[model samples]
Target: MYTLKKSLGQHFLTDESICRRIVASLEAYPSRQLLEVGPGGGALTKYLLELRDIDFKAVEVDDDKVQYLKKTYPAIESRLIHQSFLDMAPPFEGPFTVVGNFPYNISTEIVFRIIEWRAQVQSTVGMFQKEVAQRLAATHGNKVYGVTSVLTQTYFDVEYLFDVPQGAFNPPPKVMSGVLRMTPRAAPLDVASERKLFVLVKTAFNQRRKTLRNAVKSLFSEEELQDDLFNRRAEQLSVAEFATLTFRMR
Candidate 1:
């Protein structure tokens, strides 16, 4: 029997139905070139391969899993990379979609990396800790709303598709998990300098207890602080509002 490795955050999806549903969520996109992160035991990978038109590229950090995947699916050998997803660049070329049962520890980093390559990726369907998925799909004024909510919302139209119960995985995570499908927006609602917005959001949520005005004090001049929008806590502001604040601060 396969064992879940705690160090690698390995929680294999024992439910094939959930795997199929996650893949189905990306049915709108051309799945020819698909990038999967952490394909533990190839549960999801197997279903993705069954899609006739699809070509799969997977980035798996664990050496054992990497070897197993290559040996088990020789057809996808060249497509697999035994490296951390963060180390690889995106736009795996061709018409591509990204799907994975992502490791919870590095989920935020992975999302940000994907956001960096949002221009090339058609869409992304991945699993995340339920709370993180909620935050990514949260609207303004939600208690779980924070930097990730604003930054990701700025680039993608996020949908919290469904919850995967704890029992669905080999070694169940303590909390429930959810799948998120993020399609890039046609045009960002209120475009600000991305770098500035990133910094602004990071600062604002770095200390959630502080009001936006205070949190971003170092980044903005006193004159920039005159706006009423930057006066509230980070959770209280909308993504567009944050974009506007970032633009003004720049």
Candidate 2:
């Protein structure tokens, strides 16, 4: 067994039931190709490999964990990638689904990376710190709703599937964990450009308590800020509103 590295945020999922639930969530969106991020100790990898008709791959940054997984499960030797999921390229040739119990430290970064590859990532089911998971699936008017909520919901339909408790892991985390699934939106919100929308959403949330006019003054003209929408705080605008506002940006 490999040691859990705190610096890498390695809290391996030890609960078989939660593992099956995560896998079941991914299976909801059928894809020929599937990628698992940070398969620390092959908890989910074992079940994923058992699925028929899937071209499966797992990206693991931890060298020791990779070796442990290979020695423990010989079937994944060829499919396991020894690289950070953030720095790696798309593992499959076409559309694929992603599943993982993400490292808590870089969980948000992983979500953004997946968003960058949204066109080819058909769907995703991942476990995250409960608060972060709520942020991903949050809608306008929810206090947790912010940049991640708006940006992610712009292209995918986010679902808060279920929650997992701290005791489920070998080294139980201090906080609760939750699982979420994301599937491509049949009709993604219209925006001037994804770049502009990202800029607007991130900037607007930089001072989330402030109204849009004060928070995003840099991106829009003084006159444009006079609109009624500018009176609302960042968390009050829906994903579609954020996308539409991008077109009016300077």
Candidate 3:
């Protein structure tokens, strides 16, 4: 009944099989708490509501979709959080799994929020613009590889699950969508400092075409830049290699 608003990136999923497949992937990990982001049209929310074992909640930004979900699925009356996933405080007291057909407009921001909550979020299964998904699952040497690949891979093991065609939604997106699953690493990466690593990664990629020595020259000294790792470009360094560069920073 609600009109799809292009500004909000509201392309509601009408496909049943893909919805179930995504929910199944969310349940693949054992979670006592689960949260769904942007449950537009209740495509995935209905199935998640049926699960009896976990505490399930969904964050929805649109008022119409929120009212519709509460009216259609009375089971979610208390489970729904009427706020943007970006603005909401942590929904659960402890660890939880996050799933959804996330808004393409803010999909990348959603990933950054998950990273911010990396300690409490056990895993995540969400759909993203295919190019973004490729970058998330990408490794060094891949053209799409950049900030997301390194930042996300720092805390979670990225997995590209599958791709969904444009036809899968009511107002299908112009670009194809891909789904990915991210599980937290059992141990945090052994970086000298997480903040330093973040700066290092972002700075190096700010001038991606330049060699690391030139790209991140401001962050290091001439003596420190003598390492061979500085000879490579930003896209050529792996996650571990980036951490090592962080420790070497002056």
RMSD for each of the candidates: 2.0, 1.1, 1.2
Between candidates 1 and 2, name the one with more favorable TM-score.
Answer: 2
For candidate 1, write residues 1-250 as lDDT tens digits: 3456898778889898998888888886665678888997998988776778667778888878877877787766877888898988773664578899999999999899988888777899999999999999999888888888998999899989999999999888999999999998866676658889889889998988887778888998888787776678888887877777766774
**lDDT of all predictions:** 0.84, 0.92, 0.90
The clash numbers for all candidates, in the given order, read: 0, 0, 0
- Tens-place lDDT digits, model 3, residues 154-209: 88999999999999998888999999999997666778787898899999999999
- Point out where model 1 deviates above 4 Å: 1-3, 189-192, 207-210
Error of 3 at 246 (Å): 1.3
Lowest summed lDDT across 10 adjacent residues in model 3 is found at: 185-194
User: For this target, which candidate reaches the highest lDDT against the unseen true structure?
Assistant: 2
lDDT of 2 by residue, 1-250 (tens): 7999999998989999999888887757889999999999889999998999999999999989999999999999999999999999998888999999999999999999999999899999999999999999998999889888988899899999999999999799999999999988888788999899989988999999899889999999999989999999998888988988989999
TM-scores of all candidate predictions against the true structure: 0.91, 0.96, 0.97
Worst 10 residues of 2 by lDDT: 20-29
True-vs-predicted CA distance for residue 193, candidate 3, Å: 3.5
Model 2: what TM-score? Answer: 0.96
